[model samples]
Each structure stands twice: as structure tokens, then as C-alpha cells.
Target: MSRHILPPKAGHPDVICAAVGWDRPLQTYYAQVCFRTDDEPDEGEALIWRGTEPGELPTPEAAIAVITPYAEIPPRLAEQLLADMTATIGEKDGRHQAEVKRRLFGSIH
Candidate 1:
């Protein structure tokens, strides 16, 4: 799971975007997106999309298509969110790989 805080915009003051991918069999993944606003603390999360496959959430167009049913998101901001998700996934995957390597080969000096 990874989260990125969207800066306060003209109308929306507090928005947060999060993406989480679960590993599936055969090296596939299921990804989901969540949106939250600080103003509505008790409203709970707004689920943007739950992808059937791993590839759906990485691109802006695909993500926008998925999120459109729930909430309206600007193209530019959607693109930015996609970029952040990509970076976050990369970081998480890298860390997991390193951990696996360390466990198998012992600590590398």
C-alpha cells in the first residue's frame, strides 16, 4: 500500500490518493485506489477503483476510466497520481526484492 497527499487546490483543500496492489498467483496483481478528504473525517474512504488486473491502474487514461464512476478527477491531477503510484510501487517492490535476497544470501556488507 502507498499513499500520496494531494496539495490543496482552489476548491478542494484536503485530498489524499492511495494505491495498493496485492500479489496474486502467476505473478499477477490486483490493484485498488482510494480517495479521502480531510474535511469529511467521518465520511470514510471513497473507493475509486478495484482493478481486475495489474495493468489497469498504471496509466492515467485507464485509471481515469475506472475512477470516473465514483468521482470526477482532472486529467492533469490524474496523471500526477498515476506517476506517484508508479514510483511508490517501484519502491515497495524493490524493498521486497532486497529483503528476499538478504534472507536467502545473508546480509551483504
Candidate 2:
């Protein structure tokens, strides 16, 4: 799926980046953001954010990823998706964080 990672602008149509997110088994969604740096031929590997929502990730450094179906997503759908994902994947327990991180990093970005 093609996802647009938009700049944090209230009313901007053009997008500067793109992203892709997938649901993991450990009750988390890993999102990847990719963009062209310096607006040249060189492209850099962007950040991968593990979050459930937009406001849930208030900090930009923490990852404000814009993934598919989320470019124009609403708060209600985001909550529902997160709930369903959590219900399916269960909880975020230890002994799995490392595995999850490894898997997410490998698959995302």
C-alpha cells in the first residue's frame, strides 16, 4: 500500500515522504517513513515508529509516521484498529520486545 508521510502542516496537500505499516504478532504496529534528503537523487532511510495513533505520538522525535489508510484517517478508526490489533496480538510482555524489535526493524524501513 502507498502511504504519504506529510509534513506537520494543518493544510498542505503536497507530501514530502511516504510510509508503510504492518501489524506484528506482539501487539504492535511498526511504521516506516522514507523520504528524499536534500531534495536530490540521494534518498535516506527514514525512521520507523512504533505507535498506535497520531496524537498518541505527540513528539516528532518519537515518530510521527504517516502510513497507509492514515493519511486521511480519523481518531475513531485509529482507536478501533488499535483495539483490534491489541486483542489479536494480546499484550506487550517482556522476552518479546527484543524479538519484536528485531522483526519490526527487519520488515519495516
Candidate 3:
């Protein structure tokens, strides 16, 4: 199962995001972001931001970072969480970047 990280708070996280994949040839990372509330559990996990148009991040942290400021979590908490999540996810999979790409993009090769 895909790992999902929630904010270090009660109930559900105010924000959710993930590194979907990487376009190695383009040196770009693909990700998605969303906002969640008690009434909108489905809305929060949906893709509010996606890396398709350009000027997006090439790393999961960066992708998550882009949304941190807007998230309900405190800035410091959000940053720490983003860093921890990035590292944890990376460490969990040796080829985290490639695996993310493959999982999200689907057989880019």
C-alpha cells in the first residue's frame, strides 16, 4: 500500500501531498497536493496541485514545500513534516525517485 503522511495533529491533516513520479528525461518531479477539512475528507486527498504546466518542483520536498505556506499547519511544523516525510520516503525505498515516477507516471520506459 502507498504510504500516506498526515500532519502531527488531531483527526485528519489539513493538507496532503505526494511525489507521484519523475520525468527523468526532463529532470522534473511529478506531485499532487490537496487540502482537507472535516467535511471534506475526499477533497483534501484529491489533487489540488499537479506538475504538468511547468515551473513545478523536481523533488517531493519541493513539491510539498510549495503548499506548506498555504496549509493550516504551523510553518515550522509543516516544514519539519515535509523534511521528515521526504527523508523517510526516500529511505524506505532505495530508488525512491524512480519508484515514485514509475508508480505515478506508469511505465515511462
Question: Candidate 2, which segments miss by more than 4 Å at Cα?
Answer: 1-15, 18-22, 38-44, 51-73, 83-109
Candidate 1 local lDDT, 1-109, one digit each (tens):
4332222234442334434332321122233344455655544365554544334344545544543433444547555555555555433335665576467556321
What is the lDDT of every predicted structure here?
0.42, 0.41, 0.46
- Encode model 2's per-residue lDDT on 1-109: one tens digit a residue: 1122433233322334444332443333445544445553345445434555323433222232445422443445445445544454544435665565567555211
The better-scoring model by lDDT among 2 and 3 is: 3
How many angstroms is residue 72 displaced in model 3 relative to the true structure, after the best TM-score fit?
11
Model 3, residue 19: C-alpha shift (Å): 4.9
Output the better candidate (1/3) by TM-score: 1
User: Residue 93 deviation, candidate 3, in Å?
Assistant: 22
> Cα lDDT of model 2 overall?
0.41
List TM-score per model, in order. 0.36, 0.33, 0.32
Worst 10 residues of 3 by lDDT: 1-10
Residue 73 lDDT in candidate 1: 49
lDDT of 3 by residue, 67-99 (tens): 445433344543543454354343333366557
Ten contiguous residues minimizing lDDT sum, candidate 1:
22-31
